[model samples]
Target: TIFLDEIGELTNSAQVKLLRILETKEFFRVGGTTPLISDFRLIAATNRDLKESVLNGKFRADLYFRIAGTSIYIPPLRERPKDIPVLAYKFMMELAQSKGVSFGGFSDDALSLMMAYHWPGNVRELKNFVEKALLLSEGRVIRARDISSYFEEHSEFGRSLPTKFDSSVPSQLIFDNLQKIWEELKAIKMKLSEIETEKKLSSGSETLNIEETEKKLITSALEKTKGNKVQAAKFLGFSTKTLYRKMKKYGLR
Candidate 1:
């Protein structure tokens, strides 16, 4: 049997060669003329959407059909919150045994925070967090504070904001503050427009200050939400796509 990971990343020439081999089940040795018959099972996997790649001309339709006998789509970690504790413990135990640490398990609060997290980087990120927490945690159980810094760092929010969202705070108050910030931003834009009209000059420093304020708000939202982009967007009074575009514009991640 042959297993190919990321088969969609095959070059065009390589795809042609693979297609020929799959069709004939035969190939000549590199330095030989005689064709050799080979039979084997093939399994392939990729994180990319193969059909989309085919549409984009990046993947060959024939080759994709050849290997796509069966396919499985595993949702990302954030989509399956229940799996977080299971995978987190699995990683924790494996890492603890490797490092010869006598750790008991994760605290309930720790697990809760993790479940609420968005985990943008998926399983690998989870494993990394578990390992780091195990190393940092002093007690038998890993507490929320043990792994809280990981979210802040991975969220790429440079400023020190609240470690987690304050659930006790009224949602209406949060929205009111967000609305006020939005209004302030609009006022700044209007001021900048008036200045441009009167002086016929671009206020570079004022524009820089506005950008800095926007970045801070976005960062604070992500930190408070524990890296959950959807929640952060709502907190900032932005559509999810707009938040993503703004994050990209500011090179936040």
Candidate 2:
């Protein structure tokens, strides 16, 4: 697969060239007359709306039609609130394992803060935050302290309120604050229940044998590093020789 990110950023000349290649299934190297036939599936992605770009005359219509053979629209993180905790745990697990740390996962308050915040930077920002938190975390679970730094530095949601409130604050204001607190608590409880269910399901009825778990982890590390055994070995905290031995034992060679 040939993946072109930010397809909308391509220049008009580049777009025309791409269109020609897509039409003729061939391309020419710079300063070379020979046309080279290319046979590969194309997958292009862009945050910009290609249709709008085409209408605005910023993107080539024919090129857009050729590249957008199939399109998938993925909503931003804040739009799909339920996925926050799921993706958080997934990143936590993958990162923790790769770093050779044993993380139990995020605290309820930490997860709540993440869910409440509007992720303008989306999943990439969330992944960076998780990785940073993993490095800074001092315990099994990632608490609000580990995550607050990123939000405070980058998001308005992390700003603090005034130090003091009026002593004569209205009763309605107090009631509203209480109601919001109650709702947050309820949401936390629901998230906790979901995490518990996930943990139980992941643990399964019967635990895998040590060898099985080891092989699985090795395979996962290999896949994550795109079959780079040395990187996978380092990720698993094993020497290259030890990794090779394990792979041979598991018939992974």
Candidate 3:
């Protein structure tokens, strides 16, 4: 079986080559003149809409039709909230067993946050986050604080923005915001590259100072929720106890 992920990212030349192979069931090596025939099942996956790509001339219509013999649409994580806890626990248990650690599973608040999160990165991201949480967790139960810190450290905008369509916001505004976010993400990537280079050149023992970042995130959440710790905790995916501890530690009281 041959599986191609992100098939939509293929160039026109590559697409034409692939289409030829699919149609003829034969392929020639770069330097070889003879064609090689093979019988194999091909499965392709792409996040982009292939129909839109075909209409936009980014993808070949023949190639799209040939490859899309069967289509399966798996909804994003936010769209299927019910599956979050099940997958989260599965990942948590697998990680724990692999690491040879005993875990009591996630706290109620932690589970709530996992369900509430928009999960822009989807199942893979959730699995990674759970693994990281399992590793970082000091107690038997994975707390909301552990996962919240992971989100803060990795999230592009310091929080998971809703991936669902909102009727309240204008379409233009949403597009503008997405554009701005893309630019900011590019800048952030460049900055991170520079920092990584500096770290490699230096001791390599240095790590990101997440204290200030966490403080800023907490403050922002608090401000947005109007000093309501409970609301702030939910927004930041932190337990109320963890939020209070952070507030005290940061002298935000």
Q: Pick the candidate with the highest TM-score.
A: 2
Q: Per-residue alpha-carbon lDDT of model 3 for 1-253, expressed as tens digits?
A: 9999989999999999998988889999889999999988999988789999999999999999898888999888887665677677556645654666534457657877777777778888898887777677732466787678755665574254555545896978866764663443334334434444565577663343245435655776687678999988775566899889989999996
Q: Which consecutive 10 residues in model 1 have the weakest lDDT in total?
A: 204-213
Query: Candidate 3: TM-score?
Result: 0.59
Tell me the tens digit of each residue's lDDT in model 1 across 1-253: 9999878889999999999999999988899999999998988878789999999999999998888888889876765665677677557645755676534457667877887778877788888878877777742456787777777776653223222455897989877865664454344334434443443355433222335445656776687678999998875557999899999999996
lDDT of 2 by residue, 121-142 (tens): 7788888888877777742467
Q: Which wins on TM-score, candidate 1 or candidate 2?
A: 2
Give residue 104's error in model 1 in angstroms: 2.7
Q: lDDT for each of the candidates?
A: 0.70, 0.71, 0.71
TM-score of each: 0.55, 0.61, 0.59
Comparing 1 with 2 on lDDT, the higher-scoring candidate is 2
Q: After superposition, which runs of candidate 2 have C-alpha atoms over 4 Å from their true positions?
A: 157-253
Cα deviation of 47 in candidate 2 (Å)?
Answer: 0.8
lDDT at 107 for candidate 3? 65
TM-score of 1: 0.55
